[model samples]
Target: MEWVYIENISEYEGKEVEIKGWLYNKRSGGKLFFLLVRDGTGIIQAVVVKGEVDEKTFNLCEELTQESSLIVRGKINADRRAPGGFEIQVKEIELVHLAKDYPITPKPHGITFLLDLRHLWLRSRKQQAILRIRHEVIRALRDYYDERGFVLIDAPIFTPSACEGTTTLFETQYFGTSAYLTQSGQLYEEAGAMAFGKVYCFGPTFRAEKSKTRRHLTEFWMLEPEVAYYDLDDNMDLAEDCISYVVQRVLDRKKEELKIIERDTSKLEKVVKPFPKISYTEAVNILKKNGIEFEWGNDFGGKDETIISNQFEKPVFVHRFPAAIKAFYMKRDPLDEKLALGCDLLAPEGYGEIIGGGQREDSLEILEKRIKEHNLPREAFEWYFDLRKYGSVPHSGFGIGLERVVAWICGLSHLREAIPFPRTIYRLSP
Candidate 1:
C-alpha cells in the first residue's frame, strides 16, 4: 500500500498504489465508472468496473460527489488520452468525507460571486495554474538577484515618514507616535546599497490609493534593487536584463502551466533584452501623434502608457521625466535641469508600467531643498539625509510590482487574478 501523488503516478505504472485526493468529476455507463481525481499536484482518471470490484465499491462510486475526499487503491495505467497521460484501475475505495454540494459548480459564475468564494475558488484548475506560474515567477526573481551578488535586506513595514508621498500612506498610531505603512522599500534599500554596494528587498508594500483601476492594488508585493554608483543608464540596463531573464525562465519552466492559463507564449518569447528606450519628451510626442491631448510635463496615465507601449514590440524604457512629476528623491538631469534622471519600464501589449526607478539625489543640499519644495517634514527625513551627508555616491534603484508582472505574464484581464487574495478598493473578503 504505497501512497502516490497523481503528478508522479507515471513512475508507478503497472504497479498498485493508493491515491488520496478529492473527486474532480465522474461519469458512469451501466457497468463502468470513470472518475476524475485531482490532488494538489495533478489530475488523473480512475476507472471502476462493476464486475471486477465488489458491490460496495461500485455503490460507493455511484454516491461520490464533486470535491469528496477519498483514498483509493488502484493499479496505474498509461493512457495517451487521459488527463496527464495516465489512468488508474480502481481496486478499492475508502471515503474520508463527503463534501456537501460545493457552491462553485461547472456553471458560469459572476465575477462578484466568484470573488466572494475566493477561499474555495483557489482550488479551481485555472486558479491553480495561475498560482503555479506565479510561484515560478517569484522563484525566477530570487534566482536572478541572488546569483548576481545582490544582498537581501528586509525593510521595515512601518516608517516615520513616506517614501513616495503622504497622500497615499496608511497612517497608524504607534505607541503615541505616528507611523505610516511603507509605500515602497526604495528608501531603506538606499541605506543598504551604501552598506553592501548592491542590495534588494522583496516584500509586501502598502498604498492607500482609492483607485479602482484594473492595474492598481492597495497592497502589493514589490522587488526593489538598489545599486551603489549606478547611474540612470546602468539602472535601465539592469532592469532590462533582469526582466528578460525572469520571463525566459517562466517560459522554460512553466510551459504546461502557461498553456493552462491560455497565455500566448509568443508574446513572452519576444520579451528579450535591448528593449527600446525613449525619453519622456519623445513619449509625449508619441501621445500627441496618436491624437491624445497629453501635456509635456504631466505624468502618463494608464491609457497614455498603453498608447506609447503599443508602438513597440518589447518593453520600452521611458526616462528623463519632468522633475515636477517624479518623486523628490530623484536626481535632476545634468543636461536638462527640469528633467529627473528617472525611468519607467512599460510592458508591451498595454500592460502599463511594471518598473520605476532612477538615480537618487546624492547632494545633501539638493535633496534637502527638494524635500522642502515638496513640503515634507524635514525632521522625519533627517536620518535619510544622513546617507547623503556621510558618504553618498551616484546610486540608483527600481521597484517591480509583482502583481502587475503576473497579470502581464498570465495575460490576465484584471490585477485581482494575479494575487491569491486580492484587496481592492471595494472588495476585501476571503
Candidate 2:
C-alpha cells in the first residue's frame, strides 16, 4: 500500500492509500463510524462501515479514542460536503497507540485551562491553522530578503550589554560575568551590513518587561534587516516593500488557513506598495483632532499607534520622532537636531508597530556622546563603537516582530496564540 498524507489525498482520489495520523474526532450512526483524522498537513474524515469490514475491524474502530495514533488504509473519495472536500473509505486499521482519556475534550474550555494544556492544545484545528500561517510568514520574509541580495547573518542571543536599554534586559550569569539576552539584533546586524553590504538576522529575542498587555510577550522572534548606504527615506521604502511582499505571499499561499482563522482579508488585500506615510508631528496633530491628548515629544503608545493606523487603509509609517525618546543609536534628523530619523510601521485594524527602524548614527563623536547621555556603560560598547571608528558608511535597518505580524494576520485576540510556547510575565510551562 502507498503511504500518503491527508493533504495529498486529493491527488490519490479513487485509489487506496495508507495514512498514519491521530484521530481528531469521531461520530457513530448505526453501523457507520465517521472518524475525523488529522496528520498535521490537513484533516479528513474516514468512514468505516460495519457491513463492509470484518467484525474485528469494525470492533477496532469502536475502540479508537480521541488522539489515538493509527494507520488507516482507505480509498480516497471526493465529497463536496466533507472537510477538505474529500473523505476516505477506510478498509484496514492498524492501531499504533490508544490515547486514554485525552484531557482536552470537544467541550468549550476556559482560556487559562486551555493555556495550561497548550502542549496538547496545539493539536487542535484552529491552532494548527495559525501556526501554518506563521510558517508561511517566516518563509515569505526569508524569500523577500534572499531574493533582494541580502545575506543571512545569525546574531548572538547572549550579549555583553543591552541593545535598547538596561531596564528591559534579561540579565544572566555567564562564567561569573553578568550577561543579558538580546533584545534586538539591530546592533549586530549593523556590523554584518558593513561587511556584507546587505544582511538580515532572524532569531528569538527576550525582553524582561513586566507588561501584561495583549500585545506583549516576554520572549518572541524578531527579523532584522540591515543595509549599508541606506538613508531614512530608503529605509522607509524598503520597509514598505518588504512588508507588502510578505503580506502578499500570505494572501496567496495561506488562503485556506486565513479562512480557518476567520480573518477579514479585505484590509489585507489593500496591503500593497506605497503605503501611506506621515511624520510624527502630523500623527500627533491628528490624534489631538480626534480628542486624544498626546504630547508632541512623547513616544507613541499602543493606543496611539492604533489610532494612527486606523486613519489609513493599509500599514502606515509614522516617522521622525523626538531624538530623546528613541534609542541612542538612531541618527538625528539633519534638518532638525531634536528629531531622530526613525519610523514605526503600524499595521492597520489595531495591530500596532510591527516594524521599527531608523538610520544609525555613523559619527563616532555623536555616538559616544549619545552613549554617555543615556548613561549606558561605555566600556561594554567598545566593540560596537569600533565600527564607527573604522570605515563606516551610512547604514539603516529595521526589526519586525514575527509573532505580532502573525497575530495581526491571523486576527488573534492575544499575542500568546501566535507562538507555539509563549513565555509571558506570569506564566511559563509546557
Candidate 3:
C-alpha cells in the first residue's frame, strides 16, 4: 500500500491508497452509500458497500456528516459517473474529529449570512476561485514590472503627511506621533522615481469613505508606478499594457478556475490595448451629446464615467480635466490654464476609474504653491519637496486599485467578493 494524494483519478486507479482528508458531504441509499471527500487537491466520491465491510467499518463511515475530518484507507479506481470522474473504494475508515453541524449549508445562503461566516465560507468553490484569481493577477503584475527592470519600492504605510485631503485618512498614534494611513502610493513612488529612474509600489492602502456603495472599500491594495524622464503619455502606455497583460494572463492559465467561477470570458478577451482616448473638453462634449447636463468646473461623477465608458468598444481614457476639479499636484496645461495634464481610465461595462494618473509638476516653486494652496502641512513633506529642489526630471505615475480591476476582469458585481477578507466602511472581520 502507498500513501497517495488524489488530484486526477487516472493516476491512482486500481491501487490501494492511504487517504487522510475531511469528509465534505455524504449521501445514503439504505444498505449502499456514496461519501464525497476532499484532500485539498480536489474532491472525489467514496463508494461504501454495507456487507463488503464489517459492522464497525460500516458504522464508522455511515454516520459521517459534512465537514467531518477523517482518515480512510481505500482502493483508488475510475468511475465515469463520479462528479470529478473518479471514485474511491473504502476498505477501512477512522475518525479524526467529527466536525459538528455546519452553520452554513450547501443551499443558497444570504449575503449577510455568508459574510458573517467568512472564515468557513472561504472554503466554497466560488470564493476559492476568486481569491486564487486575485493571486494570479498580483503575480502577473509583479512579473510585468520586474521584466521591465522597474525597481520595486515599498511605500510607508504610516506617514506624517497626507495626499490630497485629511478628512479621508485614518489617523492613529505612531510612537507618540500622529501618523495617517496612506491613501495612494503615487507621491511616494514619485520620490523613488527621482532616485531610481523607474519604480513601483504594491501594498495595502486605506481610505475612510463613508459611502455604502458596491465599489467602495476602506482598505484595499494599490499598484502604483512612477518613472522619471517620462510624461503623461508614458504613464498612459504603461497603464494600458500592464492592465491588458494581467487580464490575458489570467485567461490563459486559469481557464478551469474561471469556468468554475462562471466568469464571462468574451468581455475579458476584448480588453486588449489601444484604448480610446478623449480630452476633458471632448469628454464633456460627448456627455452633453448624451443628454448629460453638468458644469465644466465640476469633477465627473459616476453617471459621467458610465456615459464615457459606454461609448467606446473597450476602456477609454478621459484626459486633461479642469485643474480646479483635480489634485493640485498635476501639471497645468500651458495652452489652457484651467486644464491639468491628468487622465482617468474607465473600465468597460461601466466599471468606473480603473486608473488615475497624471504628469507631476517638477518646478519647485509651482509644486510648493500648489501644496500650500491646498492647505497641506509643508513641514511634514519637506523631504518630498526636496526632490523638486534637486534635478527633478518630468515624472509621471498612476494608481490602479487591485480589487476594482479584479472585479471588472472577473465580471463580478460587488467588489467585496474580489478579496478574501474585504475591509469595507462597516465590516472588518473574518
Candidate 4:
C-alpha cells in the first residue's frame, strides 16, 4: 500500500493507502463505524464496517477515543457529502497510542481556558486556520520586498540603546553592563540601508509596555524597510503597495483558511492599491466634526485611529503629524518646521495602525540638537550621528507589525490569535 496524506487522498481513489494521523472524532451505527481523522494537512472520514474488516479491527474501533494516534490503511472512496469530497474504507488499523481522557473535547471552551491550554489548543481547527493564514501573510510580505530589490538584513536582539524611546525599553543586566531588548529594528536598518542602498529587517522585537489592550504584545515580529534616497512620499507609496500585495496574496491563496475563520472575504478583496491619504490636520478636523475631542499634538489612540480609518474603504494614511508627538529622528517638514514628515497607516474595520514610517533627519547638527532637546543621552547615539557627519542622503523607512496585519486580514478580534505563541503583558507561558 502507498503512504499518503489526508489532503491528497483524492488522487488515490479506489486504491489502498496508509494514513498516519490521529482520530478527530467518531460515530457508530451498529456494525458500521465512521471515524474522522486529521493529518494536520486536512481531515477525512474513515469507514470501518464489521462485515468487511475482522472482528478484532471492529473491536479496536469501538475503543478509539478522540485524538487517539493511529495508522490506518484504507481504500479511498468519493463521497460528495464528505469533507474534501473524499472518504476512506478502512482495511486495517494499527494503534500507535490510545489517548485517554483528552482535556479538549468537542464542546466549546472559554478564551482564558483555551489560552491556558494553548500548547494543545493549537491542534484545534480554528487555531490551525489562523496560523496558516499568518504563514501566508509573512510569505507575501517577504516576497513583496524581495521582488522590489530590498536586501534582507537581520538585526540584533540586544541593543545598547532604545530605538523609539526609553519608556518602553526592556531593561536587563548584560554581563555587568545594562542593556535592552530592541523595540524596533528601524535604527539598525537605517545603517543597513546606507550600506546596501535598500534593505529590510524582519525579526522579533520586544517592548516592555504594560498595555493590556487587544493590540498590545510584549514581544512581536516587525518588518522594517529602509531606503537611502526615498522621501516621505516615496515611503508612503512603498507601504501602500506592500500592504495591498500582502492582502491580495492572502485572499488568493488562503481562501479556505479565511473561510474556516469566518473572515469577510469581500472586505479583504476591497483592499486594493491607492489607499486614501489624509493629513493629520484633516484627521483632527474630521474627529472634531464628529464631536470627538482630541488634542492637536497628541498621538492618536486605538479609538481615534478606528474612527479615522472607518471613513475610508481601505487602509488610510494619516501623515504630517506634529514633531512634538513623533520620534526625534523624523525629518521636519520644510513647509512647516513643527510638523514631522511621518505617516501612520490605519487599517479599516477598527484594526488601527499597522504601519508607521517617516523621512529621517539627515543633518547631524539638527539631530544632535533634537537629542539634547528630548533629554536623551547623546553618547549612546554617537555612531548614529556619525552616519550624517561622514556622508548621508535623504532616506525613509516604515515598520509593520506582523500580528496586527494578520489580525486585520483574518478579521480576528484580538492580535493574540495571529501569532502561534503570543507573549502579552500578563500571559507568557505556552
Candidate 5:
C-alpha cells in the first residue's frame, strides 16, 4: 500500500497511486461522485465515474459512511477546480475497516460532547488541523531552545521534596515514604543550571486543584528553562525572546495549519521580541490609575490580569509582585524588602499568565528564614539550601504552560482544545 499527502498530488498526476485511509466526506452530483479522503498529512477528493468500475466498488461507495477505512487503487488526474488541485480516479476499492455509526458527525456538537468524544473526534479535519499546529508549536519550542545552547534535562516526576506548598502536589506512596508528583520542575531545573550552565525541562506536571476553571488543569505540560549567572532582568529578556522565537517559528513553518485554524495573523504579527516591561510598583500604579480598585499587597486577580493583558500590544512582563504572595525562594528586592524580584508574563487576549518565574534567593540565611516563615519543612529542602551555602550564582528560570501557549497561538478559546488527551478537572477517563 502507498500513502501520499494531498499537497503533493500534482506530481503523481496520471500515475496510478495506491492509497489507504478514512473517508472524510462523500458527495454526489448526478452521475459523478466525490469522496474526500484524508490520511493525516492532507486531504483530497477521489472521483468515481459511473459505469466506469465494477459493481462492488459502486455499491461500496453508495453504502460507505464517514470514517470507514478503505484501501483504494486509483489513477491521479489534474483538476483545476479540485480542492487540492488534483483528483484521484479510483479503479479499485477495498474496505480494510468499517466504522459504523460514528459519534462525531458533520453536524454541530457541543463542547462537552466533543470533548467526551475527543479520541474519536480527533480524526475530524478541524481537530486534526489544531493538533498539527500544536505539534508544530512543540517542535518550534524545542528548536528554539536547542539552537540557543540550552541543554535539555529531565526532571524527576516523583520527588521526595515539595515545591512552594504541599497542598497542590499529587502525593503517592513509594515503598514507605511519600513521593509527590512534580508541579513545576523549576527547583530541579535550577539545580541543573548550576551544573549545566543553561538547562531546560519539558514534561508533564500535575496539580491537584478542585477549582473548575478553563484555565486550570489537573495535569498539563510545562517547558521550563533555568540559567546560571542570569538575573531577573536577564530572565525577562530571555522570556520575550523565547516567546517570539516560538511564534515566529510557528508562523513560518505551520502557515497552512495556521490558515486552517483561522488564527488572526494581525494579532500574531504584533508578537515581536522586546516585549514591554513594568516594575511591580509601576504595574500596580498603572492598574490603580486605570480605576481598578486593588490593594498594594494583594495578588493580581484574574480580572486584573485580563485588564493588564488588554493594554499591551504584545505579551507584557509584570514584575516584582509582593514578596508575601510569591514563592518563598523568590529573591526579595534589597531596595524594597517587601517585594520579590519575580515576574509573570501575561499573553495578549487575556491568555492569563502563561509564564511564572523569578530570580532564586542565593543567600542561605535569607532562604532559611523565608522557608521557615512559610511554615514549610526545612529538612526537606536541605539539598536546595546547600547551593546557597556553596558558590551560588545569580540564577533565574520560568515555565511556559504548553497548552496555554498553544491555545493562544492557535486562537482557541480554551486550553483544553490544545492537547490531544487533556486532563481537566472534569475530565480523566478518555
Candidate 6:
C-alpha cells in the first residue's frame, strides 16, 4: 500500500492508501465504527464496517482509545459531510500502540492545567492551527528580507551589556566574568548593518520582566532588521511595508487555519500600506481627547495603547517619542532635541506595539554623552561606540516581536498561545 499523508488524501480518491497516525477520537454504532485520525498535517475520518473486514480487525477497533497510535489501509472517498471534504473506508487496521487514559479529553480545561500539559496539549486541533499560522508568518518574514537583499546575521544570546536598560537584563556569570542575556539584537545588528549595508537577525531574546500581563513573555523570538544610512522616515517606510506584506501572506495562505482559530480577517485585511502616522504629541492629544489620564513623556501602557489604536482601523505608527523615555542609542530629532527619531507600530484591535525601531545615534560625541546620561558602563559599549567613530551614517533599524504578531494575527487572548513552549514569569516546564 502507498503511504499517504492526510493532507494529500484528496489526490488519491478511490485509490487504496495507507495512513499512519493516532486516533484523535472515535465513535461506534453497533456494527460500524468511525475513527477520527490526525497526523501532523491534518485530520481525516475513517469509517469501518463489521462485514468488510475480518472479525479480528472489527474487534480491534473497539479497543482503540483516544490518542491511540494506529495504521490503517483504506480507500479514499469524497464526502461533503466529512471533514476536509473527504473520508476513508477502512479495509484493514493495525494497532501500533494503545494509549491509556489521555489527560486531554474533549472538555474545557483551565489555562494552567493545559499549560502544565503543554507537551501533549499541542496535539489539539486549535493548537495545531495556531502553530501552522505562526510558521507561515515566520516564512513570510524571512522571504520579505531575503527578497530585498537583506543578509541574515546571527546575534549572540550572551552580551556584555544591556541593549535597552539594566533593570530588565538577565545577568549571568561568564567564566568568572559577568554577562547578560540579550534583550534585543538591534545593537549587534547595527554592527552587521555597517558591514553588510542591510542585515537582519532572527532569534530568541530574554527579558526579566516581573509583570504577569497577557502581553508579557520572559522568552520570545524577535526579528531585527538594520539598514545603513536609513533615517527615521526611511525606517518607518520599511516597517509599514514589511508588516503589510507579512499580514497579506498569512491572509493568502492560512485562511483555513485562521478560520479554525476564529480570527476576524476583516481587521487583518485593512493592514495595507500607508498606515496611519502621528507624532507623539498628536498621540498624546488623542489619549487626552479620549479622556485617558495619560501624561506626556511617560510610555503608553496597555490601556493607553488600546485607546490610541482604536482611533484607526489599521496598524498605526506613533513616531518621535520623548527622548528621555527612549533608549540612549536613539538619535535625537534635529528640530526638537527633546524628541527621539523613533516610531512604534501598534497593532489594532487592542494588540499593543509589535514593532519598535528608530535611527541610531551617529555622532561619537553625542553617543558617549547619551551613554553617560543613561548610566550604562562606558567600558562595555566601546565596540558599539566604534561603529559611530568610524563609518556610522545615520543608520536605522527595528525589531518585531514574533509572538505578539502571531498573537494578533491568530486573535489569541494571550501571548502564551502563540509560542509552542512559552516561558513566562511562572512557567518553565513541559
The deviation in Å at residue 176 for candidate 2 is: 1.5
lDDT over C-alpha atoms for residue 233 of model 4: 93
lDDT tens readout by residue for model 3, 368-423: 89988988888867887889988978989988889998888778888999988888
Total clashes for model 6: 0
lDDT of 4 by residue, 1-430 (tens): 7889986777899898999999998987689999999889888899999879878888999899999999999899999867778998999898999999988997998988888889988888899999999899999999999998999998889999887765588889999998999899888899999999999999998989898999979999999999999999999999999999999999999888998999989988999989999999999998988789987888888889889998998999999999998999999999999899999999999999999999999999999999999988888899899889878999999999999999999899998888998899889888
Cα RMSD for candidate 6? 0.9
lDDT of 1 by residue, 162-257 (tens): 887645888999999999999998889999999999999999988888989899888899999999999999999999999999999999999888
Better model by TM-score: candidate 2 vs candidate 5:
2
State every prediction's TM-score relative to the real structure: 0.98, 0.98, 0.94, 0.98, 0.97, 0.99
lDDT for every model? Answer: 0.92, 0.92, 0.85, 0.91, 0.87, 0.93
Error of 3 at 132 (Å): 0.7
Off by over 4 Å in 1: none
Question: For model 2, what is the error of residue 131's alpha carbon versus the real structure, in angstroms, after optimal superposition?
Answer: 0.4
Q: Taking the candidates one at a time, how many backbone clashes does each contain? A: 0, 0, 0, 0, 0, 0
TM-score of 4: 0.98
Cα lDDT over the full model 3: 0.85
Summed over model 4, clashes come to 0
lDDT of 4 at 4: 94
Expressed as tens digits, the lDDT of each residue in 156-249 for candidate 2 is 9999888877458889999999999999998899999998999999999999999999999999999999999999999999999999999999
